[model samples]
Target: MFFWKIKKNPFDYLQKSFFFSCKPDVPSVNPFKTSKLISSYFKLGKIREAQKLFDEMTDKNVVSWSVVIHGYAINGFHSKSVELFSQMRILGFAPNSYTVVGVLVCARGLPDLVLGKSVHGVTVKSGFESNSVVGTALLGMYAECGNIFDSCKLFEGMKNPSIVSCNAMLAGYIDNELFEEGVLLFNRLRMSGFIPGESTMLTVVQGSVALESRIVAQSIHGLVVKLGLDSDMSVNNSILDLYSCCKDLDAAKKVFDMMECKDVISWTTMMGLLVNLEYAVDALNLFLKMKASKVNHDAVVIMNLVLACTVLGDLRRGRQVHSQAVICGIEYDLPLANSLITMYAKRGELQSSKTIFNQMTQKSLVSWTAIISGCLQNGHPREAMKLFMEVWVSENYSLDSALIVSALTASGVVAAFELCQQLHCYSLKAGFSHYRSVQNSVISAYANSGCMDFAQSVFEEMGCLQDLVSWNAIINGYGMNSQGEAALALYHKMRKSRGDIDRFTYSCILGACSHSGLITDGLMIFNEMVEENEVMPCQEHYGCIVDLLARAGCLSEASGFVDDCFEVMGPNALRALLSGCVLHGNVELAEVVAKKLFEQDPEESGHVVLLSNVYASVGRFQNAETLRTRMDKQRLMKNPGISSLGESSYDFG
Candidate 1:
């Protein structure tokens, strides 16, 4: 016992074992055991282990080969699976229906169609093409590969296809965005007396949603209910989504309430519908109810909640939602984070918005545009321009029309003329100048930057591509630049064209009349807008009319107009009259308009200043000083006027 025994090698011990000892004499166990282990490994997602075991097998049967091939295909290793299928065939192992299906699965994801074609050839050679299951798989593979032509041929060749096969083809059409084809096929299936399954009906409903046909959607809903498929959560959700897309909020809510077991998707879809319909308050209240019901809030729900808070401008609630977003661990989600930035910026909390933007690890073009637009809106145009430059220098971001528009706006605000021209050049080079929105933004930027000539040139170049916005922008530019004649001419031309004149169009022309003292033209156009164009005059139109009359030395007529429309006129109308009074030295009317303005908004120091200036212009210095004293007593401070040069310097006092 004390003697040192010789160390036995594990290899020798394995050789003496029952399996290896009978090697070459008995049937080999390695192939069978190894194949089973490979299948188990494949099931457990140990793909490398399965592959290694499969490679070591000396005799692979069709079953073992099919396992590896199917496993690789389904697991998204499509190329590796296709290679194994070829190896199996090279080994002279005849293919079965299962093998053919596995190969077809591999073919579904092949970027190169040649391999799929080869697999198809093998299926035909193996005489497994007649198998319904195999045929369906082939049809699906062709569809998934975007070979609709081949898929259609394969589908037509199938004699008396099963419902599953028909659904596969139908789904292919829908997935390819061939909604009309899908609808035609659905009708044919119905005519053939084929009762569609949940999948088939879902596809049809999707087609209906894409078509945005309310009648078709309603018919599909009725069919779903008749088929007793409305109870299915997926079908119900699809119905709800269809109604939401069509803006049928009542029908969507009805479908939502009918759902027996509402999932998170159901709740989120309903909340999104409310938000989309501009019922922000209702959306927030529903979200609170959802929280009270112990339903979990996902990123989508949080984003909706943030949007609601943004719309309401409820900073307290917005902050609460931000905290909840952090707790949910989705605060860093790009879209949700971008939404948070928008919420804070809209609330006038630029510091908080910047903090959120800085904390983002990954920023999208939309994210950049959101913060830049926020900066511009919050009166930080210089900062916004700087951010735009940073975005431009970064190669990771591509400039979209939205970002371009935002940057152009910032450039206009800062009076960065050179920068504006550079952006215009870049837009042309990037091929974004052709985009109607970008073109409009460029026009507005040039006009706001005191380049009406460039703005007009862009407008004239738009030709037939010019939309209503283009006309409005150029007309407004002319009005702002005191080119009232040009503005009126453009308005007349727009009227002659196919462009439908809107309220904004009328407002711009009226503004031109006010600036150029075209009282008769203003009154005539106002009548045309109402009677001919059927455009209802809004508060702005009323203000324009009052200004037009006041500027034309018809102070009495302006006052009478104001009295006539006093019920509908806001402070802006009175303020417009006050401005005209200041211009024409009508102190008496100025006093009346200022008093009305004060009653409307007590804190508006501009109205006080304007009236004081009118008094000073009329040599009533004592009255002007008295007004200044009253302003001091009330602690009202006039907002500083901002003027900018071509560079970054701005004068503010």
Candidate 2:
């Protein structure tokens, strides 16, 4: 039944019947018709029929072997094609350039670099290394196998490398994210007086975005313009993508507007750019215009619209787009589905998000990541942890670095140190322990959970990949848990590393000094912040210094500092001083602070309490009583503090 299920080759059976019944020469009488029949069967994707005709041939040569190998390779049966190549070799057929290219492509699909290299040796022995077509295939095979070393070796050894070979190496570098190398080769190719083809242009444009090389990207753009390749739609689309990825939205829009016939991809790219730049209303208007003009909406367009709905916070319109996606039958697209999940999550509709996520027949890494992040962002940290754990348990779902990072964030909420340990182990097993994002998450998770030793260890291990966020996380963690000395040490280390410290890092270190009463270090950091770092002190930065002075019992100094900077003091800075007065029982400063606080927010009963308490401490009972009477008239009561039975009880309920 399995054999009969395949379409039968009628002519082959007839020819066999004729050879058996009447005469063998009858079949040999019409060679042209027989070859056409065999070719037709192969074209129809009837591989079994084609194989049956091959078996019926009294004698087979390189031509028959080429047909089967090319057919199998084209039909995606790469393993079978490689097997056929071996069989043809055993049959004493000389492998030509065509046969080698076909089998090289099949070898590229092996997913095993060792096997690909072994087959590459065969191509070298076959004397097809000098052939441009065969050389390109070999180079592509090495590149696709993730063996860029072998690819570069092959390219360098070539006596007269064609444009195809150069382009292949350039593309290989790009695929590996070696954008600088790709750009250099592109320049060399241009300087060597070799004109780039369409593929070469696309590769360079893509590499430009990958490397964020604006100058090289502009050079490519200029070349395209000068060569009149801008009119080509494919080249224009690539240029548009390059501009968008570079965050040059203005340039991207210029390219889009200049296109004579804008496709759905162009419009979608523009809409995405608008959404990224927070022009939600403009993005929505563009979507409406696209729909009004009857441009064909593909999966990408729907994904962009879903992202727009998420940004605009228009849940009503989000549902409409979801409905349109369902009606258009593009709802099954993973990216679109993921975008919908994110949209619902952003709107605080966890139930709707979960429902859509459950309905997906096809789930990808992105789809799973969306739902996991949605749970975390929408205040369902436990659910996020649950989904993340499930993802780790499944083998088909590769553990992405982002998934681990998101889970670490959720785990740190309850200080799930055990879960953090599991992620660390997973990172080691996946050989991504040094991944920057993963290492940052480990440091942050440890730091937030008060595991300072682990945080420091992770930070120390991060030799070079520590960006501003990593340093800020560790510094802020130390400040939060009252490790002022350690925080200051890290800030100095960051400065030594030539790291450009931002306001967050400074604010964190200043806060540490305020709480720990490090007056000298605080002053030094403050001076450096203003003069050396050249970071204009925000109100928060200034407030930290005032609070630090107040904590150190430098009341007159604090008051002088506040007076000197009264013009620059924001409302929060004034409140910080009022808090300092309450801490130090300074009724004189409290009196001046009360007037500022009351003017800032007359309804704040806490400031009244602060003023009354300050007055009571100074034996001015009548003033204190008058403050109480004003509080009664305002009808605002101070919030009483509540005590829990046990600290551990808070974790569960």
Candidate 3:
């Protein structure tokens, strides 16, 4: 009757009236219910759909804003979450505890310490500083930004800190590598009736893993089961990882078996443990077991399997895993790809590595580093330099210290002075000069390039900051250039400042003495090495001394030294003596040294070449030719075995 009283359009009018009359101000779709829909959308990974629905909501409150912001945060749209957070504040909407947590997650994604501090100010202004949830979020944000000092100060200022805040602080400590302090805090908290949650257990497990403290790991493991937190998947996985990292495979296996539901991480951790113990074959077997259980293969699991094969020197198995990864359609995974590159490089399959690298559509910084290092490791220094320069040309990567160090090594080996200068300038520009490793590599590269002047400059720039490696590199550089006096002087300077010189330091100094014919200095240093006993004289140290004496025409003294430490010197000192014999025309001494080398190892080609030269040097063409023929038929020759020092470093060879 009401519809007929109006008109043809009256029915539509009546429908609207009836619809609005019942609910009046209440929306047909409840804002809270709409918020839930957005959350559901986010859960389904429909970020755009959720955000659109949130934008269209006209009846949104603080809770409504929180839902979408939190959705963005959880979905890794950190910048968008921050943008929404800023918009909400500008629009005069006050954020609640939930909003603070969501925005703080975004803050943690941002590396700028200042942004985190600004967020902290907002929390303080909002009077959420003492609120446990907000305090935890704030603490985590600072810690993630590497501002541990402020995180500590904020935590210490909190009164009646909740278990969540305590867990955050503990995790922060572990994340920043303050492992010992984290463990100590856990001990103190345990005495104060602080019951740990699953997150807390995970953090504690991390601390124990970092310290590799077997006792602490076992204790925590017992606690995890007793407290029933082992039911948490993350907790279970972390517990397994802890036992594995501590090298307690039996305990790790026990935890693995006890896990009611194991994920890919659990399998990876267990396999990693086996690999660490050099039981890589067992690790492969475990992988087969994992497959039979139908967990499905992931990129990480396959990558770890490849590493296991690489470690076992099972190149055949490695190839099988690589094929499987390709068949599984995860061959392009960055980590898996990087592992394969290293595996192939170590196995002398550099071409295969280069192929894989060329096929990658998008390369990560790690990808670039892996290929460059692989090239260098495979003894292709110029190739390494080529790839490194490609990284610069690509400009997609921000250089890390390790990658820079590798490039520097390649540049030095190729002895490209222009490239060296460029790398030094680039390092200074890129702020990598602050890294001691980079500085040391630069010095070594400069020295290797025969640029003692630039090497000296970098060494002097290091000043008091020069580490043991820096000292070694500089001293070796001086020796390489035949500036024996300079090398000896630098070694003395290093001795005054760094008294705890290791075997390498002594080796470098002795090498300098040997190069400069400072026989007395070499003997004094050798005696000092013996006297210190801190760093026992190794084979290289003894070889340097033998070379020092032999080069000074003291074959009798060098021969006596070799006899005195025959057990310790191995075959290297004999190789040096042979070279010295060639240098000083002592054929009889050279033949005796060659016989000693053959006795040590019958397969090394180094001393064979040296002795052949010695025979030819004394106008014995027939003797040299016989030795050369035996060298050509390496395996067939019974008496003449190759020595370890192939293509000897001494110029007399």
Candidate 4:
């Protein structure tokens, strides 16, 4: 009886033998033939016809009810199907495992977990819980309802779970972000000799993607080839995505190249990943290849293409993508609009950015963030702060960490110190202060506003939870305030605390020593940066050391260091040495430095003006006049020095 009941198809047994010998009240038509016709109508999407025929059935058995219920469920008439199941129960017709499975599908569709649990009770009451077909349906229903724990319990209670149940449970695990456990179950099932079908392999590949395990990805790749599913588009797309997630671009490209029938998903996946992995130019090339092919572009693909353009800083191509997006009819896409705003802002095309931003009928938080960041980037801090105030005042949109950080940056640039304090308090009230980014931004804002006492207070309140940025902010804050001794003390204290010091930390500390004329400490720190921190001195590091030595009237030693380490020392080091020459009345050495400067980059007029001024300071008016004539001939214009005249104004352009 158990083996016989395991047969899933309701009409297959009837074809072999008359399982339902119906007594036709109307003798002209056969009831069994009528039931088969109902199923055919349902399959053909003729639900009204199927239901009309079902209503005509006077002698309805369990098979009759199950067929109509299953038809209605599969045809997307879930509420009606569930109503029929309830009516069948009230009519005293006992539901078999097949009937239970049909109603279970409806329960999942309606997302009625209460109905599903009640059905589980009925399945148990009818002893149909042991049936594989019923068990798999129940497993799927529970998994669909986000009740994986109950699904797992139900599976364990089953006598012998089927492959369908296993697959359902694996999907459940993936849904709940339990990929480690899902992979383990897959391996156990694979080792137990259950040959996964195409869908199972696809799910396994998805789980491996989440795990980001190279071993699992490669293993699945081998299985795909071994099982001859390499040509399966869905499976191939998933495998391609998995390889990219694992950071194995070579493997991802290989899979993409080997795809027999690449689809839009394949192109989108590679396009997005290439852009994300900083291979923006390659992504653009891939988009060109995709355009050359038969596949048409979608909104997501266009957005990715825009992103590639943005990353490459190719404003011409970015505008072209914008044009093509309209031609493709996705100009109204919100993500594309936001991407365009960011692209234009980054490329210094603020007018184009604001046009896209203003035309947007509906703006997301990203929209606000992008435009505000653009304002700040283009030196329009007043505009950024005004927009930020609107969001804060209206309370229409909830501010996220990124948005708040942008606002904090704007406030630091132009807003008063009190405004920065208020933003900090608001962040704390809104519970965004816990985010490391927000905390760091607040600290930097306070430090930049020349409020080290507040910066130090915030840093101390963070206690042991302080990040590298926090330490750097406070340390650099001290240095900027001309409290060089305090900055050096904090640096030593940071070392004692075993805090990780990045290259920025060295830059800050060296700048502190440079400002205070602590030449010995600055030299020792630069040596330690190379020997202990193993940090290769970048241009900033070299510039800071040159500034330190030059400021201390050590022109000879500073010039020698420039000669020795000339490779890394670019314009910054040269500028620092030239400033030292002007400060110390060394016209001879300034001439040599100016010669090297012209050899490297002659276009810079400020350095040349400094050398001319040095000659003029020693009463060499002829040389100074000669230099000014040469400057005019070369059309070398230096930016006029600007002084800050409170907010919303600069003394000069």
| CA lDDT scores, all candidates in order | 0.87, 0.81, 0.86, 0.87
Model 4 lDDT at residue 103: 85
Each model's number of backbone clashes? 0, 0, 5, 0
Q: Write model 2 residue lDDT over 196-295, tens digit each, in one string.
A: 8788898888888886656666778899998888988889998888887777877888898899987887888888888888788888899888889889
What's the true lDDT of residue 329 in model 3? 93
lDDT (Cα) of model 1:
0.87
lDDT of 1 by residue, 1-653 (tens): 21222244555555666456686754666666777788788788899898888777777788889888888887889888878888888998888888788778877777556777887998898898888999899888888888888989999999999988998899889878899899899888888898987888888888878898888889889989998998899999999999989989989988988788888888898998898888999999888789887898899999999998888888899899889989878999998999999999998899998999999999999889999999987988888988999989989987998999999888877667788899999999999967998899899899888899899899889887799999999998888777889998888888888548788888888998898988899999998787874788899999999989988888889999999989999888898889888888999989988988988899989999999999999999999999999999999998765677545476575
- Tell me how far the alpha carbon of residue 242 in candidate 4 is from the true structure, in angstroms, after superposition: 0.7
Query: After best superposition, candidate 2 residue 262: deviation in angstroms?
Result: 2.1
Screening candidate 4 with a backbone cut-off below 3 angstroms (N, C-alpha, C), the clashing residue pairs are none
Considering TM-score, which of the candidate structures 2 and 4 is the better prediction for this target? 2
After TM-score superposition, what is the CA distance of residue 613 in candidate 4 from its true location, in Å?
14
Q: Which ten residues in a row are the worst by lDDT in model 3?
A: 642-651
Across 1-653, the per-residue lDDT of candidate 3 in tens digits comes to: 75566766776687777765677575486899999999999999999899899888988888889988888998989898889888888989998888988888888976657767887788889888888888888889999988898888988888888888899999999999999999998999899898998878888888888898889888998898889888898998998888888889899989899888987888888888888898988988998999888887689888888989889888998999999999989999888999998899889999999999999987888888888989888777767877887788875778888898999998887677777889899899999877899999999999987899999999889876789999899999998778899999988887887767888888888998999899898899889778878888889999999999999999999999999989888687899899999988898989999998998888887788788888888898898889889888774443322122222212122
Q: How do these models rank on TM-score, best leading?
A: 1, 2, 4, 3
Q: How well does candidate 3 match the true structure in TM-score terms? A: 0.70
lDDT of 4 by residue, 1-653 (tens): 74575477647766545645654464666677888899899999999999899998887888888889899999889899989998998999999877888889988988899999999999999998778888889988998888888988987886667778889889988887889988998888888788888899988888888888898899889998998999899999999999889989999999999998888999999998899998998998898899899898789999998999999999999999999988877886999999999999999999889999899899999999999999989878878988888877876788889999998888777635777899899899999767878888888788777888888888888876788888898888888777899999999999998657888999999999998999999999999888875678899999999989998999999999999999878888988988888888889989998998898888989888989988988889899999999999999987664343454445353
TM-score, candidate number 4: 0.73
Against the true structure, what is each candidate's TM-score?
0.81, 0.73, 0.70, 0.73
